[model samples]
Target: MTSAQVAKEHEGGEGNRPEEGYERGLGSRQVQMIAIGGAIGVGLFLGAGANIAKAGPSLILMYALAGVIIFFIMRALGELLLYRPVTGSFAEYSREFLGPFFGYFTGWTYWLMWVVTGMAELTAAAIYINYWFPGIPQWVTALVFLIVLFVANLISVKLFGEIEFWFSMVKVTAILGMIVIGLGVLTLGFSQAGDTAAVSNLWAFDGFFPKGVGSSLMTLQGVMFAYLAVELVGVTAGESDDPEKTLPKAINTLPWRIALFYVGALTVILCVVKWTEFADEGSPFVKAFEVIGIPAAAGIVNFVVLTAALSSCNSGMYSTGRMLRTLAENGEAPRVFRKLSSTKTPALGTGVSVIFMGIGVVLNYTVPEKAFGYVTSVATAAGIWTWLMILVSHVRYRRAVVAGRLPSSAFPAPGGAKLSWVAIVFLLFVTGLIAYDADARVCLYVMGGWYVALVIGWSVLKRRDPQVTARRREPEFEKL
Candidate 1:
């Protein structure tokens, strides 16, 4: 069958209908919240403290620049999603536009990316739990969270969406509250006598770039990592009740979300507390609250960050399950993963992914101090790879449209293919930054081994299943 035939078979055929495949249970509201929740995670709530300490107030600029690049990347993804809204999303796009090898690599790599990311989020969740239950072991916290989210996912996609919706709402409320209170303190002098909340705090202490421009540039890797799951909105398209409406709205709102959440919130944070006062170990939100004399700031921020971590973990599980099922559908993974539950969820895939995430609980006990750093670095590298694939696929997708091989998408990316190139170059620059850092260089080394293993695994799977290889080599698109 031709590529168009394959897409039709997967998307509209009776065998792949909602009752047999993924249910379109995720409503527009759930999708919108999931998009927002995915963008704001532990990276902003907790990791921003260290980034602020490293680059002073200048970190805000890095986030803005990175947010621009992320916007372009999402636009590229949005175009592709509208062109063909599949559960596989980028992986399927890679198969059609790049090649099957790329499809296989992208799908499996993304699965691994979320697996590692889920581990990191679980670790962060454990640490946040420590704030409330000092005597509970970190591993126990990780285990409990893992079990709870795993069960939640196994139940149904709607349940998962509901959980994410509420998780994201809490995060949104916290940031908005912080921004409102922060502005009050800044303009109305609503802070303690010694706490001077003013916009001048951005540069009063030691200027915005206290650590020099180069130091701020170095934090781009972390800033990019914060935007890792924003493209998850694309993944949701396959199960979204209204992909055409919800996907575009979610992608278009990128700038506004970043402006309000990251740029606006961070600006207020710095205005509330000097960058010098932020600690690498604690949350800037909590610190800002304490600076303004909030009595339960630590506990409140702890709960927010805890929810952030859980939100990420929840999203990671959902994406991994769908991705694994996609890989199985494309013969990149075992056939067993293609099996769906009565509710149309990829239960087997979710179970396997959770089993691996359980190892994160063990890592929390074995290497508690270094676990987050290690997994985050690897996740960042993997995330970069996924973004690059999206851009490349978009470039080819546009070419196909221009060549009259495919229909023009309703939501084409602005600047056409040029913006994709720009985003691709920016992603490469961030990858270079990762390689330049001694602490982060290990991620590249790990990725090197990962790709090597993928090639080897692909070779083995090809030999064992020749028909699968042959099917992959077939035309990915129908010729006009």
Candidate 2:
């Protein structure tokens, strides 16, 4: 078959309908920043302390290694997105490459995954607020923010994009500010509030990797989890003004993003503070300022952390809403989910996503402390599944490419099969490691159960819809 024939086979024949809802509404800049913003989450700000404790200074290398794996994942996704730029990107790819059953399962699985993440984001907002008031109930706080963001999403897609733009900007500014400030402290050799130590604190204690390779392995869970949402770029490709233009730019820039955002920030912190101190205590970002004897650093970092949570919440809402609408488009969900409001946002889909997040309020009300970690683990598990699909999709896409089916395109993910296989191995390893850890073991079971449920659901869906037996086919253009 020719490339065009392959495209047609992928989209379910000539009768495959063009999308009616949601125009190419976002700018290239908005798309770029959204990708950057979505990838950099509160984990880097808050979870780094735990990672530092685990690998000692070697946590940096762990993040770098994880980034390499993630880069492959994104590259595979990028290739797939370039092939079929649709609202239901990943889910659609699963259907095209694997089969309808695979598509239905992956689509709904991803939708549920983001719903869990959205809930976790709302719950996190409450915890961050408590650092300030310490009096208000976390449930109330979570609900209020959820409702507010829900309304923002309902009003317009543009508003959601705008809000996310600024929210992401806040996160970027804070991390960049910390990097700049940390660099100054590193070079000038300023004294921390609690310690009169010099800038060699990073290696001064026991040298990097104090816990050996074991600690580094332990820390991979946290760092990789933080990077889980990086592929939100592929998800956003459908709504972009031009996927051909924007998606490639975003995917190609992954390396710098990993370096500057993850590596750069952690490097500065380790240089300024003793990894042992942060491991023994808490929040290296906040503690670094306290060490410098800045009285209000905690307050400032708290505010920044609060913004980070809100940013994640905003992105979560955006991602889940899109995923739900994509599911609807694929006939896996109710047709109502694919409907867009006058403002071109999936108003109903957005509402449903927020309602799912509202469940977080209940969790916060009933079990405030454990709610955050529980939801985070669940979200992580779901995200891992989504990434696994992306890897699988890429492998299948490459087979098509080699079969003389796919045209060369921008935004290529290197290491084709080799990296894809490595990423799959790493994913399984992460799951196994999670099983080993007392806290993360539950996620393994939860994700496993979720996939099983998805498979059962897929069987019912295939049985009910004879049309799903048809394959999706796409048209090919020779040049970009």
Candidate 3:
């Protein structure tokens, strides 16, 4: 039988077990849409302005280099997922191949990443709402946006899928429109009445590496974080209709998607306007639109950015819910998290995630400006850790495959062991950059605290109950 058929049969009833819960009818299109939907959010639309300012003309190289590194990371993840299509994805792979400590670190770190990102988006949504109704308090706006996402997640997995699909469509449309209009402005040399539109602005502004190569490297601190959620494709393997077929289709398309959406849009934007003009603007997207003569560019771009933030918040909830559910299934979390509603969604986990995200409402009120920076930096920490684990998992996986322990017919990452090492080292370099960055330095401490907490918890649990530890170790031993 086909993988889709197998998945359908596995999900025949309302079983909430990991094997069944993940087998809900997520077709290839839904999976593809979800992957794209979960990705391409506020980081690109709302956060790119900050990056554009940091690297100046060299911002293009920063994104391109980051994209290439992420491509290799995704391929490594795809290869690992093809062999073990589980709900928690990389967390599962880490547990199975690496060990319990790795699994514990990976799962909680990933969960924290989503939660923090969700809060950041929620807070950003409130700020956007303030743009329309400055009278409305930031807390109120955050509460409302959080409630909406909570409800959407509560209803059904498919509802979340549907919301993500439309959310992504809006982002995709904005990106494409920006790129096309940017090209038009470049070709026809159109600009605001006070300025001359010339493509030469791309290189004329203190040369391409105005800030030097170190500046481009510094931008990776944010650029890599922006691409963090791109691997949500693999996380859906368990819920997908055909892991073996649909997953590969989604994985294979990632390269093109990155090229067109990220590299393509950034390249065009840089070419259309001089890097000097991008500084201090809240959004380069708005600048691009205004330069193309779009009326009420601020409001139009505000709407787009609001949607992007909401989309990111929504995706953050979905990712957290799934990760927690997977943890529950693996006995790493409370069993209640594993419970699924009739819709095959992690009902309890979604509720908990929403509550966790609601903490942003309080943060929005207290220290508004610092909210975005704090969340992005912390999310960067989690993202790099996750990527590092995926690379480690791949290395272990190849060893298994080579020893005739795992099947070889699964999707293979290019260059085998070598590329995995390259990706790992590159990710380490990005982490080093994060350490060098003053804004991102706090992330190391935060993530370090998190690991310490997890280790303490694990140590206590180990002393309290040997059975729990054994249960957790069983799957790892068996898989390895």
Candidate 4:
């Protein structure tokens, strides 16, 4: 079948479609909050300290530049979502526009990305818990938090939305508060740690690029990791109550989010407390509040960062389940995963994902110190693949549009296919940066093995179920 026919077959039947199994319970407010929450992860809250230490204030420019590229990628995704919103999102786009192999690879690779990402988040959550409960073992904390979040996700999508809403509110409120307080300190000439708060602090101790351009370039891996989950909003298009309105509004705000949460907040922190004061091991936000003599600053910042980690974990569980269900629907995964609960939740898929996340809990026990860095590196590399596929799929989608195989999108991407190529090159450069770092090179190696394994698994599945493989090759949808 042609790509156009495939799109119509999967567009959710008029009245009694199997797609109805997914509850469109996420309202505009929840979606907006999910977008905000996805953009701001524990990376910004905690990992920024290391980047700032390495790049000094030049980290702001890194974020701004990366944010622009990310915006182009999102616009590309937005155009595709507007063309045909589906629960599968990028995976579905890849299937129709690129090819079935790409579709399979994108779907499963994305699922693997989130599963590992959830592991990293769970590790961070455990570390954060140690700040308050030094007596607890890290593995115990990780396991407990994983179970709690897994249960929360299994209940319903609405509950997931509510949990994310409050979690995002905490992160947003904390950043805004820090920005306001940092500005106040600068204007009122508050002195703390024998250094007066002033904009001059950005350059007084050392120039913005204190470590040189090469050193700043080294931090791009971590900087990109911070933006890992930002495109999660596209995943929500399947369940959003008003995807036509909410998806655009949520995506359009990417620029300001980078400005305020990343650039604006980092500028304030540097001005309030010199970048020299931040260490690679602790949160700059916590240290800034501490230097300013805020009582319980460590505890407060710890609580906020903990919520940020949990929020990411929660989102991971939610997205992995949906992606798996999409795979099953497309005959790329086990049939059992296609079943949804009466409440329209992918209970089986979520349970399976949580089972895999248990490996993270085990790693916390065996390699607590290295688990976060290792898993995060792998997740970042996996994220690069997912983003690259989005750009590729969008390019193919535009070709289909021009060839009269698909209609023009209501929310067309600016610059169209050319911008996608630019973004693709930017992603490649970042991947190269990852290879340049001896510590991060492991991620690429692991990702190489992962793709090899996926090819083997795909081959095995195809041989075992020739009919399902044939259906996948033909590009026509069948009713569940």
Which candidate comes out best when scored by TM-score? Answer: 1
The list of candidate 3 runs beyond 4 A from truth reads 1-17, 190-195, 471-480
Q: What are the lDDT scores of the predictions, listed in order? A: 0.86, 0.75, 0.77, 0.85
**lDDT top scorer:** 1
TM-score leaderboard ranking = 1, 4, 3, 2
The TM-scores, one per candidate, come to 0.95, 0.91, 0.93, 0.94
Candidate 1 — worst ten consecutive residues by lDDT sum?
11-20
Task: Quote model 1's TM-score.
Answer: 0.95
Candidate 2: regions farther than 4 A off:
1-19, 191-199, 279-281, 469-480
Error of 4 at 167 (Å): 0.4
State the displacement of the C-alpha of residue 196, model 3, in Å, after optimal TM-score superposition: 3.3
User: Where does candidate 3 have its weakest 10-residue lDDT segment?
Assistant: 471-480
Better of 2 and 4 by TM-score: 4
Candidate 4's C-alpha runs over 4 A off are 1-11, 14-20, 191-195, 467-480
Over the stretch 1-480, how does candidate 1's per-residue lDDT look in tens digits? 433345556555522321236788999899999999878988898889999999999999999999999999999999888766778787887877788889899988999999999888898889789878889988888989999999999898899999999999999999999999988887778667235777888898779899999999999999988888998998888888888889999889889999999999999999888898877777899898888888999999999988988998899899899998888887889889889988888988998999898886686667758657878989999999999999999998899778977777778899999999999999999899999999988999999999999999989988998765555433224532
